[model samples]
Target: MIPQTDPKAGYLAQRAEIDAAIQRVLDGGRYILGEEVAAFEREFAAFADARHGIAVASGTDALILALRALDIGPGDCVITVSHTAVATVAAIELTGAQALLLDVDASYGLDPAQLEATLNAWPATAARPKAIIPVHLYGQAADMPAIAAIAEKHGLAILEDGSQAHGARLNGIGIGHWGKLSAYSLYPTKNLGAIGDGGIITTDDAALDARLRELREYGWRERYVSAISGMNSRLDPLQAAILRVKLTRLQVDTDRRRAIAARYDAGLADVKAISLPRTRPGAMPVYHQYVIETENREALRTKLSERGVSTLVHYPVPVHLQPAYLGRVPLGVGGLKRTEAAALRVISLPMFPQLSDAQVDQVIAAVRASV
Candidate 1:
């Protein structure tokens, strides 16, 4: 069966280069926070058009450290959508803050209008609003311009969750352009993934960058001396070396993802039983999952599976409705109508840079027959 995603294929695509980089790291004998990590930080920062990059152990740690660096903790409330990986909300709570969940728009990003209305209606006794994390879900950017405007008006900080949007652009600007700081996950299936777990935070502000660097290494102004309370979340040198090689091919891989998305759009346009992924005007999405919505999602998924085409749900459950967070997480005024609806209908088709035109055509044919 055709797989929904293939991280192993990504490694095989550049096996020689990846193997050589691993050898170099092992030969150096300096594994943790070494030159490999530093070099990747510089290279990735330049790629993201940011002044600095702090490499971390995982994407969740990236978000937690960023919140800590921004001085957001205890009693502070962060606004973000529930239609995202639980990491986004969990990170905020990990930093000793409360997560105020919001809903998503048609593009599956945070709804900016809801944001404005929520801020206007916020009770005086509520926790003081501190930040907004607009997740670039499924490799598409949220409405940053509108979100930025609302954030500025309310004096709130914006920390973009760009884990799935490595090369995405909105109105010709990069994904991280509109936010104070941006965090990206380098998990194996992500657009610019490493061979193993890794994450990075980017920012234009020098002070924020310094604080991030310190926080990732136990708040060390000097070795073994804590300048402040912090945790250990340094990126592994092996993964850093692997990511350095992968980063070089990110744009090319993103272009291939877009090409596959275009193919899917054309092939599936006539299927009235399903809705294709929608792209916002002026946005360049990298199509991490190429999600399609259907009223009878389970039936369609089963049909596709029976035809030898594999599929997966981007998220089967919204974060707020999950066991740990149900009845505890706060929602925006109108509730998570769109977010909950999406959780039920969305299914990810096969998407990865290494997928050939033949595989894509097979998927389309299977979908057409099944749907």
Candidate 2:
């Protein structure tokens, strides 16, 4: 079976080198927060064009730590997109801050107009959100230029959620470099997958970086010495080694994804029922999942499944509806019209660098036929 076409296949296409790297980690006595993790952090930071990088245990932790580092806590609010992984909103709630939801736009990122309108009407109040967290949804970036402008006017900090886009670029620069602290996930299926769970935060601020480094290790400067209250979440050496190996070919792999996306755009152009993703002139989508929208999405999904083509909804529910976050997160800013609309229509196709051109054609045909 083809399974979900994953970059792991491409990585395994170069498996011998990856195996040796993992073995080297095994040989080293130190495991957590070792040389491999350090190197990967530095390499990844450079890849994102950020000055400081901090390795963490998971994507969720990355966001939580980012909130902690930003000092967003009880009684504070954080404005962000509703059309994002629950982890994004959950991270804010987990930090004792309120989650304020905003809708998305045509690009399926944040709707900057809606964001500004909400802030203009709501005016933070006693729940003044100290920050704005926008997702670079499905390898596509939100309009950072507009969001940055709004944030500046409202005096809100920006923390970009870049979990889906590893090497994704926006307006000539990478996603992680757009805001103060951007979070990334290295879940196995990501564009730059790790063997297991891993995450990182990239930034140019040295003081925040140093503090985060200390914060991940139980606030310890050395063994058994607690500098402050912190969590025990650090990237494993093995995952780091695996990621280090994967990092070498990230851009090349991203290019292959783009190639497939281009084919989909060309081949599936006539299918009027489907709405394809849009890329900014200077931005590049890593095509993490090739999310598309259709009116009869459930029918389309069932048909796709019957045809031996696997698919998933990047998210079926907006963050507001999730049970885990009830009472904590606000009911969302007004209607969240775009957010709710996307929740029903968006579907994630089998996407990865290893997905062949022919497979892309098969996917296109399947989608076209279904529509």
Candidate 3:
């Protein structure tokens, strides 16, 4: 069956180069944060047009480190959507802060309108909302201009969750540049993925950059010195080398993804039962996952699977509704009606750089038939 995502194919596409990169690291006799890691950090930061990049062990750690570096912890609260990978919320809790889950807009991003209302009605007795994390869900940028204005009005810091939007842009500027700092997950299925778990944070603030470097390695200001409390989340050299190789072809791969998304859009345009993904004005998505919405999602998913077209839900449950958070987590005004509806309806079609035109056609035909 055609898989929803194929990280193996991603590795195989660059096997020769990847294998060489691994060998280079092995032969270099250094495995920890070394030249390879440093170079990848620089290259990736430059690609995002940021001044610095802090490589970490995983995408989850990227968010945790970014939050900690910003001095957001106990007695603080962060605002974010509930319709994202749980990692986004988990990272906030990891920083010892309260996560105030919010609803999303049609773009599946933090709704700027909801954000405005939530801030205006925030209780004086509740924890102060210190930061807002606008997740660029499904490779589409959040409504940054609107969110930014609201954030400015409330004196809230903006930390973009750019895990799914590696090369996405809004209004000609990169997604990572919209917030004070942005975290990206380099999970195997991401647009610019690594063989294993990897993540990075990008920022233009030099002082914040220096603090993040220290935080990723036991708060070390110098060798074996703990300048402050931190954690062990350094990016290894082997993964760094592999990521560097993958970074070179990221733009080319992104173009292929967009082309595939366009094909799906055109092919499924007439299927009234399904709604295609939407791209906001002046926002360029990388199509990390070409999500389609339908009321009878499970039946459609089953039909597609029966036809050898595998599919998966980006998220089957909203974070706030999950068992662990069902009654405990707080929500913004009017609750997550959209988030709950999306959980039951959204299905991610086969999406990966290695999916060929013929394979894409097969998916399109299967989806058309299913709908």
lDDT of 3 by residue, 227-290 (tens): 9998999989999999999999999999999999999998999999998998889999999999
Question: In order, how many clashes per candidate?
Answer: 0, 1, 0
Cα lDDT of model 1 overall?
0.94
Query: How many backbone clashes are present in model 1?
Result: 0
What shift in Å separates residue 93 of candidate 2 from its native position after superposition? 1.5
Question: What is candidate 3's local distance difference test score?
Answer: 0.93
Question: How does candidate 2 score on lDDT?
Answer: 0.84
Candidate 2 per-residue lDDT over residues 250-332, each given as its tens digit: 88988988898889889877889999888867777788878889999999988888877888897998877678754556644
lDDT of 3 at 175: 96
Global lDDT of each candidate: 0.94, 0.84, 0.93
Model 1 CA lDDT for position 277 = 86
Estimate the TM-score for candidate 1: 0.99
Query: Candidate 2 at 326: error in angstroms?
Result: 4.7
**Candidate 1 residue-wise lDDT, 47-92, digit = tens:** 9989999999999999999999989999899999999999999999
**Candidate 2's error at 269, in angstroms?**
0.8
- Our model 2 lands, by Cα RMSD against the true structure, at 1.6
